[model samples]
Target chain A: MLKISGINASYGKIQVLKNVSLEVEEGSIVTILGANGAGKTTTMKSISGLLKPNSGKIEFLGEDVTGLRPDQLLRKGVALVPEGRQILAGMTVLENLEMGAYHRKDHDIASDLNKMMERFPILKEREKQLGGTLSGGQQQMLAIARAIMSKPKLLLLDEPSMGLAPLVVADIFKIIKEINESGTTVLLVEQNARQALKVSHSGYVLETGKIVAEGKSDELLNDSRIIEAYLGRKSS
Target chain B: MLIEQLINGLTLGSIYAIVALGFTLVFGVLGIINMAHGEIFMFGAFIGVMITSTLNAPLWVAFAGAIIITAIMGYMLERFALRPLRHKQGVSHLAPLISTIGVSILLENLSHHLFGAGNHPFRASFAEISFQIGSITVYLVQIVIFVISIVLMITLSFWLGKTKAGKALRATAENLETASLLGVDTKRTITMTVIIASAMGGIAGILVGMAFNSVTPQMGLSMGLKGLAIIILGGMGSVRGAMAGGLILGLAETFIVVYGDSGYRDAIAFLAIIIILLIRPQGLFGQKIST
Candidate 1:
């Protein structure tokens, strides 16, 4: 479980996140839906410790982790699959997967790795291939698979559905649902309102660094303002 | 005659390759040029001399000691000088370069003050032993340096490829922010990179010290410049390319000195770099990554 309260984050003098707050229960897929320049990515980054919050609290699994380093958060079983698939392009697919579990000292990594390859057969097929050479869809799958390697308690995904074909997007959303069903708590940030609400247990709508609405996924999906602004409907 | 020159070139090439490898590693990981790297190399030789003279340790122990000590110094420099500048915009890149130069000058002055600016002999007396092959005579020191360099290169390659820490390092090199998100301690990784690079520089210094029996503080600048040229010639941040570039530069220098004049060696090397950059600015094998 995670709780973010009254968090403010900035890039230099320009504040990006202002008084942002949200919560995610254990094993719940919490979706934060917002348009471009709405500080959705900033909120995720602040939680993952890539951007230190100026003022607020980020408690993950009952520990106050507001100012921790990214690695420290990771060691505590928190992981972030960043906005872009920032895979080490020069490294092989297997190497990228190995890098995902960098903090783990567990000896059963080989078995876990096998499990990952089993889940993504394409990765196994191209295990020796450089990450850069992979197709966009494969790279996205690799990014998610790589994140899964860490066996994270809480996974923060920022825009996983970005830059994918419609079919690929559906496949990725299905994977997200499967990942959530398998008991990993996920906080997904997306611009795809329909797809994100369909799978998320709960959802929040953010506008200009402020959470404008929060409710059950179905309720938020049916809300009139959400339909007009984010759901791409004509206003009555 | 060509065979003799080739053998001699290999010996010199091995040393430059090691130094260039160090440069590329540090530059690759942190995006800092480390102008003080050559000074660290000089310090390694000085450390070797001190260990051999005062502790009377074996040659291998002295060599290892030099590397370990200089590496620690590098770690300290990273913590004290580099980390503070990590978040600073625009001028942050120049800070490390300037700070490293400051450290270089500081070390040079200290060594000069303490060692009295004279050429110092390393305690590795085994360097005097030589072997003859056909018409070519090879000093035992040259052979030892060449063998150790090869061993070090193998060890470095293994460390980078086969180890978890090495993978983390490569990740850090590729994308520091992303690596951190994946659980790499960026602070620690950066420090480790500096240590590894400085250790290589130290080893190169010891090889140079042993081969020539002349250790002077001023030697760091020339060695550092040569390393810069080698890295540029190879392509910035390419380890294998550094090795190839170093060999090319070293052999070219050796051939120039042998057939022409020794004074023209540096000029010819720089000219080669200009020609290479003109032909392929990205470097012989360097990947054009935004550092």
Candidate 2:
């Protein structure tokens, strides 16, 4: 489980997140849905320790992890598949995957790698190819597979479906669902309300760094205001 | 005579390659041109000289001492000189460059004050030993330098290709943020890169001292300039580019000195680099600098 309380973050003099708060329970997928500049990505960055918050607290499994470095957060099993799928472009597919477990000293790494290969067969086929040469969809898959390689308990996914084809987006959502079904808690940030709400158990609508609404996915999906703003009018 | 010149060029080229590799490694990982790198080389040579004369150690011991000492110095340079400027507003990039120049000047002056500004002779006992191979006479020191340099290059390549730490290094180079998210201690990786690069510079310095028979406080300047030229000519941040560029520069310099006026060697060599850059600005193996 993860808890963030009244966290305020900024980019220099400009404040992006003002007293934002959210929570994710164990073994569930929770999504933060927002339009552009709603501070969804900033929230993810704060939790992953890429950006230090100005105030408030972030707790992971009952421990204060506020302002820990990204590597420190990673060791505690928090992995973020960042916006734009920041794959190691020059590295080979296999090398990129190997980097996913850079901090692990356990024996399961090799087996986990094999499991990743099995799950993403395209990656296995291009094991020796450079990561930059992969297609966008393939790169997104590689990014997700790389995040999972750390054996993370809490996975933070930011805009994984952005800029992908509809078919590719559907495939990614399916994989996300599968990943969540495998018992890893996921905090997904998405602009794709319909798909995200379908996959996530609980959802929050973020607007300009504030959580405007929080409820069960189905309830939020059918809510009149949310339907008007996010989903549009339902065709009877 | 050409064969003799070629062999000599190979020896010189090997040293350039090692130094250029050091420059490329730091540039690749940190995206900062460490102007202090040449001073690290200079310091290594001084350490080599000190060990050989004061401690009366063997040549190998001098090499080891130079590497270890310079490596520590490199770590300190990153930690103290460069890292503090990393997060500064607006001038983050410029600060490291200017600070490294300051560090270079500081190192050069401190060594000058300590060792005095004169060329110290590195008296290797085997410098006199030579073997005649047809028309080309091969000295023991030349053979040692060539062999060691080649071995180091191969080892560096292997380490980068096969090791876990090397993978982390490449990841850091490719994307620092993503590498950190993947659990790589990027700060440690950056420090490790500096240490390795400085050690390479140290090795090159010692070998150059043995070859030229003297070490000076200002020796790193010209060698460092050549290293910059070589990396640019080959392609910045490309390991293979550094190797090829170094050998090319070495051969060109050797041929220039053999056939043309010796004084025009550095001028002609750098002119060739400029001409090549005009043709392909990315160098032989360089990718366009991505934003």
Candidate 3:
């Protein structure tokens, strides 16, 4: 489980995430949904320690993880498939996956790599091709697969559905479900509230760095206010 | 005579290429122009001289010591000088260039103060020997230096291609944030990059010292300029481009030195770079460089 309370983040003088709080239970998909500039991405970044919070407490698996560097967070089995699918463009598909397990000392990396290939058969075909050359949908899958390569306990996905075709988006969400079912907790950030809520166990709505609503996925999906503001229902 | 000139040019070209490799690698990866890189190259030669003379180490030991020491120094510079400027991208871009220049001046003065201003002949006993191949005379020292340079390049290529650390370095070069998210220590990776680049420069310094049998404080500045030319000619970040550019520059300089005029050697080398840039600004093998 991961717990974050009273987290504040900023870029220069402009504050991004103000007193934001959230939680993710073990082996469940927890999504943060918001429109543009709702500080969803910033929240994920703060949890991953890419952006140091001015004041807050972040607990990952019952330990204080605030202010840890991104790499350190990864070593402690936390990984993020960052926004825009920042795949290493110059590297090959195999090398990118290898990068995911960089902190591990285990000798079964080859087996794990093969497992990733089995999960995403398309990647196996392009193992030797440069990552930049992959199609957008493939790149998104590769990003998530690459994250799973670390054997992470908590996987933070920011906008995985962005810029992909509908079919690819469905395929990616299916894999995310399978990944969650196989015992990894996921913190997904998305503007696609409909799809995100469909797969998530729980969801939260963020507005201007503040948490506005939180509950079970189906409840949030059908709530009159949630449907009006986020679920695309016209207001009465 | 032509054969002799070609061989000589290749050897010298390889040296320039080595230094250029350092320049291009650092510039390509970090997007920082480490003006201090030349000083690091100079320090390598000085370190070589110290190991061989003061420590009474053998040629191989001196060479290894020079690279390792310079690498550690490069890591230190990245950790202390560059990492602090990470948040300020605009400032970070210029800080390394300025700080590197300051470091270069500081080293040049330090070398002057410590080793004295006089030029020192770094005479390794190996310099006196040579093996003749027909009309072409190959000094054992030159052969050794060439072999060392080739071996180092091969090792670097392999390390960049086949190793975990290398993959991580490339990842960082492509996207630092993603690399960190994937469990790569971006700070450490950048430091490792500086170390590798500085080590390459260090080896270049030793090769130059042994080949020419002389080392000076200001020599690095000129050599550094030549390295920059090689990188520009080869394209900024392409590894193959660096080697090819270095060889081309070397051959051009050699031909000018032999057939055209001695004084025109530098001029011709620089002119060739301009011509190449005008024609293919990204060099022969490099991708189009983004400003």
DockQ, all candidates in order: 0.60, 0.67, 0.54
Model 1, range A33-122, lDDT digits (tens) per residue? 999999999998999999999999999989899999998998888888889778778899999999888888899888999999998999
Q: Write the per-residue lDDT of candidate 3 for residues A71-173, one digit (tens) a residue.
A: 9999888899988888778778999888888888999999999999988899999999888889999999888998998899999999999988999899888
Interface RMSD of each: 2.9, 2.3, 3.4
DockQ value for model 2? 0.67
With candidate 3 superimposed using the best TM-score fit, by how many Å does residue A59's alpha carbon deviate from the native? Answer: 1.0
lDDT tens digits by residue: candidate 2, A186-218: 999999888999999999988998889999998
Runs with alpha carbons beyond 4 Å of true place in candidate 3: A234-236, B50-57, B88-92, B288-291
Worst 10 residues of 2 chain A by lDDT: A227-236
Candidate order by TM-score, highest to lowest? 2, 1, 3
State, as a TM-score between 0 and 1, how close model 2 is to the true structure: 0.97
Model 3's interface RMSD? 3.4
**Which number leads on lDDT?**
2
Residue clash pairs of candidate 3: none
True contacts kept of each: 0.78, 0.82, 0.80
- Return the clash pairs for model 2, or none: none
| Winning candidate number (DockQ) | 2
